[model samples]
Target: MEEFFKKYKIELEKEELEKFEKFLEIFKQKNSQINLSAIRDDNGIIEKHFVDSVMLNIFLDFLEIENPKVADLGTGGGFPLIPLAIVNPEVNFVGIDSVGKKLKAIDEFVEELELKNVKTLNGRAEEIGQNL
Candidate 1:
């Protein structure tokens, strides 16, 4: 992944990389117990889930807002938001999923990752939007 990130000119700090590595381990372990994602392989997870999520950094970097907020609709297994939150600690992320079990897993991941900027909502977009 170091070479992969370097190839793409993605700048990830050592600590961030370490956190991602830890996240990978945790993700794989949990995935085996319960189907986390259709893309199960490590390379697939890294590319599709982790890197794909981090790619949003390019847009987030352009945000002029002081406290940027993002919502990942139908977030299955916490994908972009989890990786995004890990990298962008200053930005707040909301992951909305209809599945309570998936959200529970996300909560566990957030606690294990010691993340302060990530929150999960277990509801469909329509229901959540109506409330807001």
Candidate 2:
């Protein structure tokens, strides 16, 4: 778990980390309610979803982002966005999704975890990205 902590240490507070633990539990419970996640089991969620999402940090420095305004287009199930927010609080993050159910799920997750630096928008990326 040290590696996990090291990876996410910049963003997650002790309380947020604790909340993440609880969020996982709640996600598991609520996931059944909404089918928000494909990875049903805990190991799958941890390995495939969580770890995989956290790994995006490897690209930021390589991509030479001092600070960037990132948009996670079509961020269904909050994949790279949620975990990315947990790993790099300094980076400005926005998650855009067209699915209302998915956005609701993400809103609950964001609220429960109290992730301050992340925001979600319900719209098509093409429509909004053009405006930006």
Candidate 3:
């Protein structure tokens, strides 16, 4: 897993790699039971979900804010939200999804990953946007 990230020129610590490993395990275990996503293969998840998600850090790394807060709309299976939160522990993340069951899986990911900088919200873009 670390090799994959390194191939993409994404640097990560040993602890962060461990979290990503556990996160993948949890995702696979839960996804089989709940059918949380259509992309199942390891490379698919890695290239599409994990690496692709963490790659967003390139943009965030330039942010000048003291504490950055990011939102991932339609965050099915936690996608970029989980990956980013793991890599960027200083940045706060809120993953919003309309599917309540999916959000439950994200909650599990958050707890299992022991991530302190992440949160999940159950709502749609328009509905949530109207309120905020």
Each candidate: RMSD: 1.2, 3.2, 1.1
Q: Write the residue-wise lDDT of candidate 2 on 1-132 in tens digits.
A: 334545655444675466557667877887899887889987677667777777787787578777787789999888888878876778889999999898888888888877887899999999888887
Candidate 3 per-residue C-alpha lDDT over 31-130 given as tens digits, one digit per residue, 9 for 90 to 100: 9999887988777787788999998888997877888899999998888899999998999999999999999999999999999999888999889989
> Who wins the lDDT comparison?
3
The top-ranked prediction according to TM-score is 3
Candidate 1 lDDT, 16-107, residue by residue in tens: 88888888888898888788798788778888888888888888888778978899999889888899998899989999999988888889
Off by over 4 Å in 3: none
The better-scoring model by lDDT among 1 and 3 is: 3
**Ranking by TM-score, best first?**
3, 1, 2
lDDT of prediction 1: 0.87
lDDT values, one for every candidate: 0.87, 0.78, 0.90
Q: In angstroms, how far off is 119's CA in candidate 2?
A: 0.5
Q: lDDT score of model 2?
A: 0.78
Order candidates by lDDT, high to low. Answer: 3, 1, 2
Could you tell which candidate, 2 or 3, scores higher by lDDT? 3
Which regions of candidate 2 deviate over 4 angstroms?
Answer: 1-19
TM-score of every model versus the real structure:
0.94, 0.83, 0.94
Candidate 1, residue 116: lDDT: 94
